[model samples]
Target: MSCSEDPTCQELLDHIYELVDADEDAIDERSRALLAAHAAVCPSCRDAVDAERHVRELLRRCCGESVHAPAALRVRVVSMTTRVRRTE
Candidate 1:
């Protein structure tokens, strides 16, 4: 099944950045484990998570270790995720 058709994929996408980011507490452990398990079995989800990590690493390298997301960006991200969840 394609990623687009998989609810797990939607979950992955919705939390992709959190899953790959350095913040370990961004998600609860159980939810994180579920996402990790799904990514392990779903190549598409794995790739998406990997890509997010890669981008994060690239940003850190280019912008320094102190690289941080702007507050506005965080707001927008939360808004986007909320909209996605509402649609589902």
Candidate 2:
């Protein structure tokens, strides 16, 4: 089944954040299937997800270790993110 037959565009985008955040554990099997189906048809979303994965891989290779984000930086990021609303 394709995205249209299963997940709608909005549904795919909603789950895409988990993919972009590299939160594989957070994504359920259903979301993964929907994403795979969407990727088969939507080249733009597929390209974007691929790019995000590549960037994450590059960061991992460059750092070779996870760095703890400062509490203040985290707070600032959270505050900024909260100030903005997701647009469809």
Candidate 3:
């Protein structure tokens, strides 16, 4: 049932959002380990993780209720979401 044991489980796990909430070490040791193992062999999953990180950073930097990202970055994040959803 662990994500690392099954590609399908890994993919499903990657689609979840909480992976981004965890600290880097925790993410790597836990969440990202599954996705990282899969990503090592799968370019698409690598791209998804990269994109998710970028979007999360952008949100933290600019998209909070108290702050806003540049219009262009906002648009890019929104567009990335569309692409992410398609891949999922």
Candidate 4:
């Protein structure tokens, strides 16, 4: 189902990415149901789910530790946040 047709579908799509590393058999019924339903009706979501899984697997293989933001990127983000907060 298109996200516009069912808002829950988009939430389900998002949840699919979150659940990728979780134990499939241990996943809650609600998530499993959403995944099953979405995969059945939405090729785009299915592809998204597959792509996310592949990326996660690749990351796991290439980087055992979680990725960290570069110091420069972190400083830039902090500066941007500070400016935004000041403006607000």
TM-score top scorer: 1
* lDDT agreement of model 3 with the native: 0.60
Error of 1 at 8 (Å): 1.2
Tell me each candidate's RMSD, in Å, in order: 5.2, 4.7, 8.6, 8.4
TM-score per prediction, in order, is: 0.66, 0.57, 0.47, 0.49
- Clashes per candidate (backbone, < 3 Å): 0, 0, 0, 0
Q: Which structure among the candidates has the greatest lDDT?
A: 1
The candidates, ranked best first by TM-score, are 1, 2, 4, 3
Q: Give candidate 3's TM-score.
A: 0.47
Q: What is the C-alpha lDDT of each candidate?
A: 0.74, 0.67, 0.60, 0.64
With a 3 Å backbone cut-off (N, CA, C), the pairs that clash in candidate 3 are none
Candidate 4 TM-score to native: 0.49
- Model 3 CA deviation exceeding 4 Å by range: 9-16, 23-32, 64-88
- Where in model 2 is the C-alpha error above 4 Å? 1-16, 22-36, 86-88
Tens-digit per-residue lDDT, 1-88, candidate 2: 1234476656666566675664555566666776767867888778867877798788888887566679999789867754563432
Tens digits of per-residue lDDT for model 1 on 1-88? Answer: 1123334787788777666763465666666777788999999998888888888778889999877789999899979977886797
Candidate 1 residue-wise lDDT at 34: 75
Could you give candidate 3's per-residue lDDT for residues 1-88 as a string of tens digits?
1345545534645544545555452234454566556766677666776787898787777757577568999689868976876796
lDDT of 2: 0.67
Cα distance off (Å), candidate 1, residue 79: 7.1
Instruction: Output the lDDT of residue 18, model 2.
Output: 70
